[model samples]
Target: MIDLLAPELKIVFCGTAKGTISARTGSFYANPSNRFYRTLHETGLTPERIDPAEFRRLLDYGIGLTDLNQVESGMDRVLNEKHFDLQGFREKMLHFRPRLIAFTSLTAARIFFADRTIRCGLQDRAIGDIPVVALPSTSGANAHWTRDRDHWYQLRALICRAENPSWGEEQKATE
Candidate 1:
C-alpha cells in the first residue's frame, strides 16, 4: 500500500493494483514473470537491472511507482470501481508533478482517462502539466497482447526527446 513517490522525477509508473505475488512479496512488480523491471533496463531508463525488492532504488533513476486501485490486489477484471481512487491518483500526480505518468497497463490508464479510447503509447492529453502514457501491461497473463517491447522503447524515446531532443535524434539515426 506504500506508494514509491517523490518530487521532480522523470517518470512515475502507475498500475491498476499489485498482483498477488507483488503484494505478498511487498515489492512492486515482484513476480518474476512481470517484465516491468526488465523493461526499465531494456529501455535504457535504468543503467542496470533492478530487483523488485529494491524498487525504492528507482528514485535514484528518476522513477517512481504507484497504483490506481490501492485497496485491492488482482487483475483489472476482478476489481470493482470502489477499489479505485482516481481523485487520490490525481492528487498524487499533482503533488509529485513528475514529467510523466506512465500507466503500466492499458486497463489502469483507461480508468484514469475515464474512457476506453486509450492507446498503448504516449497519450494525446496530459494530466495537468504532466504527460500521460498507457503502457502494455508487463503481467505474464497479458503476454499475448503485451509482447511487443516497441511500445516500451517508444516511452523511452519520449523521455529522451524531452530531456534532449538532439540526443534522441542521434539515437534514432543509429537505429
Candidate 2:
C-alpha cells in the first residue's frame, strides 16, 4: 500500500485512486503521460525531474498525495462504495490539518463527498480551516481536459504562493 509519507502534510493532493503505473511503481502520478508531475516541475515546485521512488520530495515542498480509493493496485479494481470512504477521509483530514487540500478531479471530489453540486476550482466550504480546491483531472483518459493550461496555472499559482507566504500576501494586497 502507498501510505502517505507525511501524514501531517501542509498541503495534500487527493486523487481518485492508484493507476496502473502509480500502483506498480509505488508513487503518485507516476505515469509519464500524467501532467501532474510536469505541472509541478514547470511551476518550480521541484528543482528537477523526480524519480517515482522519491515521492517524499513532495512533502518537503509542503505537499502530500493520497487517494480516495485505497486499493493496492489498478484504478479499475476499486469498488463502488467500499473503495471511497468518506468517513475515513474525514478522519484523515481532521488529523492531518493541512492548510490546503486539492482534488485532482471533479469526479473524485464529488464521488468521495457524495456531493454532486460542487463544481470545479475552489470550493466554498472548508474541512475545518483547510481550503479545498478541485481542478480538472490530468489523466490521459480525461480527454476533455487533457491539456488544461488554466488548471495548471491555477495549481502552480497556489503552490507558488503557499511556498512563499510573503509573495501570496503581497499579491493579495496588490489585487
Candidate 3:
C-alpha cells in the first residue's frame, strides 16, 4: 500500500505492516473490524468516519499514515526482524517532520525502540524533535487493548493544545 505522507502533518500513525485485507484492498486499515477510522472520528480528529479506502483523505485532517514493515503484509506473529526497516522509518520521520508519531501497536513501537520496554503514551525519546507515542492497535485481533480509548482522546487533546494555546481553558474554567 502507498504511504499517505506529506510535510508538516500534525500526526503520523505508523503501523507494523499491512494486514492481508489491507494489502488486498490497496488501502490502509481495510479490515472491517479495524477501529482506526472510527476512533479518529470519535476523538474529533475527523469530521466523519472515513472508509479505509479513502485513506488519502486523512491528509486533509492533518493526519498521515505509514508502516514500519512496508515490504511485508501479515500479522505480527508471522513477521520477524528482517521484515522491518527501522532506518527507513526513522529517515522518513526526520524528513517529513510530522509533529507527532503514533505507533498503532505496542508491537510496532517495541520493534522501533529496539525491544525496549515502552508505554502507551508519549515517550521521552523522539525522532529529532518530533514526539512519539504508542497507541493500542486498532486491529480486531487486538481488541483487548483497542477497547481503551483514553490514549486516543489524549492524543486529540494534545494536538488541539499544540495548535491552539488556549485550548481546553474554557473546560477548565467551567469545571
Candidate 4:
C-alpha cells in the first residue's frame, strides 16, 4: 500500500483516486494525456513543466494532492461505494489544515460531500477553515472537459487567491 504522507498541505486538491498512470508512476495526475501539468504551467502556477517525480514542489506553492478513494486505479476501476470517504477524509482535512481544498471534478466533490448541488466553481462551504472549490476534471477520459481552457482559467483564479487572498475579492469587485 502506498501511504500518502500528510505534508503541510496548503491547498489540498482532492480527486477520486490515482489513475493507472499515476499509480504506476507514484505521482498524482501523471498521465501524459492528462492536461494537469500543462494547465498548471499555462496558469503560471509553475515556472516550467513540473516533472512527475518533482510533484513535491507543489508544497512550496502551497498545494497538495489526495483522493477521496485510496483504492482504484481509475474511474472505471472505482465502485460506486468507493467514490467517497467522508469520515476518513475529514480526518485528513483536519490534519492537513489546508487553506483551500479544490476538488478536481464535480463528481469528486459531490461524492465526498454527499451534496449534488455543487456546481463547477468556488463553494461557500469550508472544511474547517479551508475554502472549497470544484474544478472540471482534466482527465483525458473527460472529453467534454479535456484540454478545457476554462479549467486552466479557473485554476488560475484559485492560484491567484492562494498567492494573494484578497485578490479574488478585489478582482470580483472590479469585474
RMSD of each: 3.1, 3.0, 2.8, 3.1
**TM-score of model 3 relative to the true fold?**
0.90
For candidate 3, lDDT tens digit of each residue in 1-175? 7789999899999999999999999999999988899999998889999998888999999999999998889899887779799999999999998878999988899999985688788787888877788888888887666456589889987676545646678669889
Name model 4 segments beyond 4 Å from true: 1-8, 80-83, 146-151, 159-175
Clashing pairs in 1: none
Please estimate how well model 3 matches the true structure, expressed as its whole-model Cα lDDT. 0.87
What's the CA error at residue 31 for candidate 2, in Å? 2.0
The estimated TM-scores of all candidates read 0.89, 0.81, 0.90, 0.80
Candidate 1 lands at a TM-score of 0.89
Q: Candidate 4, clashing residue pairs?
A: none
Q: Write the per-residue lDDT of candidate 1 for residues 1-175, one digit (tens) a residue.
A: 6999998788899999999888899999998988888989988999999999999999999999999988899778888989799999999999988878899888899988888988788888988867788888888888655455578888776776556647756887999
Which candidate order results from sorting by lDDT in descending order?
Answer: 3, 1, 4, 2
lDDT tens digits by residue: candidate 4, 1-175: 2434364555677888788888888888888888787777787767787877778787777667888878677764455565457778878888867766788888888887789897777788877766788888888778778444575576656655755789868988999
- Over 4 Å off in model 2, which ranges? 5-8, 76-78, 159-175
Q: In candidate 3, how many clashes are counted?
A: 0
- Flag the better candidate by TM-score, 1 or 2: 1
Question: Residue 22 error for model 4, in Å?
Answer: 1.3
C-alpha root-mean-square deviation, candidate 1 = 3.1
